[model samples]
Target: MGELDSTLGAVLIAGLLAAVLHGLTILQTFLYTQTSGSDGPLMRCLVLFLWSVDTLHTALISHTLYFYLVTNFGHIGVLAAPTWSIIVAIYLTSLTGIIVRIFLAYRLFLLCGRYRPRLRVALPAIVMIPTMITFLTGLIFASKAFIVRLFARLDTFSVYLYITFSAAALADTLIAVSLCVLLYRSRTGIEQTDSLLTTLIVMTINTGLLTSIFALLCLITYSIWPLKFIYVGMYFSLNKLYVNSLLGSLNARKILQAKQERSTHDHRRSVRSTRFEVVSEPASYLSPAESITMSGVAQKESFASTSNTLHQNHVPDQT
Candidate 1:
């Protein structure tokens, strides 16, 4: 009973939590569709793809739990082997994570590309290397688990699981740090623009750290209590976090835009008759939402020859 409690009980609870998070993921996706009509087709397709994958992920894990706790309820021996659904679900989790990471890496690349061509190319590659490692190791982890087919023998190749989580953590940390550093560096002396950058930096840290913390927790719990399913439980929630973070970032563009508008209005009022002009520059960091814009400027207090600037006009409120 103690063994069953630790293994099956933990998975059951984790699956419940995952179901709850999946509900939130669905809500966020619906909200995204309603609010992001102006977003490019590629962005729309990406959102749909992630939601579909996550839905399937939820279904598979649910089936796995059902198979153990209900279908084979009286057969204690069944707990020794993993269901095929659970292994495939783990692979899907990896797939969802890599897709989100690649999207974020591209955003980071856009942010850095204007400042230095080499940096733009190099930073995304650095992030992706670990990301790809995580994905491949995850594939290998699933394959080995399917081959071994027994819970008791997982330790024999636990190294693969460790590598998968470790590489994921590294990739997420690199992306967060790189983005925060670039946003910090983008600060113009203008209070509105600087505040906007600060907000973006904070968002990057929170989202990035959220996933990274769970990956580490999964790794830590598994290391300390290898026989328990606590790590698997954590793994269940981790995929949902990846999807929600992406959606949250996308949705935040509206809030940031509203804040930028109010700040711009106040700044304009303070100067009374002063006019702000948008100068032309290459390397636009305009996102699908177009919340903030950067351009070349000759201002004395600007961060660089190219300055962080927000316009009075932007995408209409999607609400």
Candidate 2:
């Protein structure tokens, strides 16, 4: 009973949580397609591809859960045998993570200013090494899981699991750090731009930390309890996090851009308002007749200044 609770029950809970995240994923994907009209076709296709993959991943998990708890209900021996859907789901998880990593890495590349040294340009490309390792190892793990197809012998493949997760963690950490460094360097010394960059840096840290922590947790739980399904549960949720993080970053761009535009507009409006106040301040102390005469004089001065500027601009320069 306790084993069932730890293995099957843990998976059940994880699946439910994953389902919730999947719901959020669907909402985000819909929102992105609708709101991100300015995004290029390639980006649109990428989002669509990820959403399709995630939906398929969810279906696979659902099948696995049904097989274990529904079709094979009360069958303890069935727990020892792994379902094909479960094995394949891990591969899909790895695929999602790698795709997102690649996307973020490219963003980092562009973030590095064109005039910067080659080392900065190459840093994000270098991070792909660990990203590739993570994908390859995950592929190997899934292949081995297919061959073994038994929970009891899963521990034999612990080395591959460790390598896969470690590489993922390392890759995520590198991408986050690289982005932060580049964004920090790209700061324009303007308050608004610098503030926007700081927000991006904080976002990078948070998203990177989230995925890396999940990978580490997956590694740790498996190391301690190889035969249990707790790690598998964590793995299920981890992939969803990757997809959500990518979507969140993409969606945030529109918001940040809007904020910048709004701030600039507000600043200009404030400046105009201040100029008006300055022109009217002296008039506040004048009697009504005096104020009327001052206003007329001010209008004449403004018209004279505008006429002079236009005449100067249109007149030919005498050499």
Candidate 3:
């Protein structure tokens, strides 16, 4: 096989790897549903929807690779040829990205709270608009690929692709930053609560960084090495990362919940032990002054009760 063929094969290999990850995420989602059993209908539907989109994305990309490698068989020219499957794959990728972004944006909105000013709500939404626009523009330009057989004629297409990736990266960065900030601010002085929040912050950053870096890499590789299919592999894996990130975030809640519960249980136990110690302490262990003070208080209480009883008897005799 030629160098170009080998490069294309690498793209396929990347797609396969992405598919494997996607399968694992599917299992994770399934296990999450079975184990958690508390996710509402909306959450369940969202998981199913994201999984379906991911499945479609994998199928489309696999078809595109299969068509190029198996059917065309060494026809390097087919790489430049825009097939229907390739167009659909591009569309699906964009769709998957937008859906995930929307989900994240909603999360940010909820985290910020409804009482937050309108500007805060609008900020993330505004940033995401460009991302959606660029993705749509990229999809539109991809359709133009069919007519513009000359790869050189598709120079403008690269601009749309780059913008799309940049916008996506920017949005991801905003999401991560916002989530981290909100989570940090929400931290109570309590150790257990803060620790849980810290875990969430770390996960948010890691997941956001993973997708943003992939998007940036795709943008860089596509712009610099337009002739090669190296960037295509990253592009194929991009949606998988997004899906996995979302599912992983969702599944992580169970773990966080368990930890939080354990922390609470330990805290309660400590409190109970403290109270028991305070209650069970013997008076003999008190200081001499404290014991004298206790005896005087008890004597006063007894005298007051006897006086009250005598006053009641005298009142009946006078009546």
Candidate 4:
């Protein structure tokens, strides 16, 4: 009983911290999209949907914990009976996970063009199907949790939950690896472009790794100590992690774009500086005709250079 109390307390604390971070990330997403104006209508809609789901998830979990700790304090039996709030929380979490997985899968698809058939996109898409199935099954089982009196009596449900978490972890791993591989292959020999891709690769790993690690932790704790609610702690925070990851990924485009613009600007400035240096050199050593010819050639070169720069600036960056 003492251990269970401590575990429940930990779950509540973790949930609170996760909610705070979720709110902060939501603000970040809003500010980033507004400033960048890069995300299209579809992308903006997706971001809004994710934020709403995350808010609902946080509210549901907060209600569940509050009901147990404050409204029904000293009644441990209430903790054994699954509430509608928690069940809905589970559904939202699974839904968020599926959405995020599909989003990344789409990114992988885009990154790997169809010009040449490859398993990069196909493999992750295949893995996601099972992941979605297990998550749905787990949600269904969770809704039936009221039939069991205690956490220890949920052996059948535990199996589904374990599979759900395992599948999620596997899907994340595959997405991260596939994205890294595609990005690595796409790196051009240009240093600026390569640096931008490297930053993207790192962001991909960080986001995917965090969610995968939490899912694995939830699975491990549930398997080893099914009687405890420690796994619930991890499960409650999963949605926030997914939402933050998605938002973070979307917001990153601004950074990449800014870096690319700066790189291009620097390159242009260097070319202009070199041209000026050549034009400013002494031409007194040559005859008047030669000097006149040199001046004419330099003027034509300057005009061409200015036109090229304007065209380059107007053209969109494919990256």
What stretches of model 1 exceed 4 Å from their correct place? 273-308, 311-319
What would the per-residue lDDT of candidate 2 be over residues 186-239, giving only the tens digit for each residue? 665555566677887888899888999999998899888888889989999888
For model 1, residues 107-193, the per-residue Cα lDDT tens digits are 877777565999989999999999999999999999999999998899999998999999989998998899888888777667777
Q: Model 3 over residues 1-319: C-alpha lDDT tens digits? A: 6666546766678778877878887898787677557656777787888888888888887787778779998687777655576567677778777888887777776666656778457867775886687578768767777667555576756667777788878878877887888778866555666677789889999998888899899888878877667777788888888888888777777677687668667766765554445445536688656655665565455445534432321101000
User: What's the true lDDT of residue 65 in model 3?
Assistant: 73
- In angstroms, how far off is 134's CA in candidate 1? 0.4
| Candidate 2 Cα errors over 4 Å, as ranges | 277-319
Off by more than 4 A, model 3: 118-120, 280-319
- How do all models score by TM-score? 0.84, 0.85, 0.82, 0.83
**Candidate that scores best on lDDT:** 1
Worst 10 residues of 1 by lDDT: 289-298
For all candidates, the clash counts are: 0, 0, 0, 0
Residue 27 miss distance in model 2 (angstroms): 0.8
**Positional deviation of 204 in candidate 3, in angstroms?**
0.3
lDDT of 4 by residue, 51-146 (tens): 888888878888887888889888777766666777778889888888898888877766666653566557666857866875787677677675
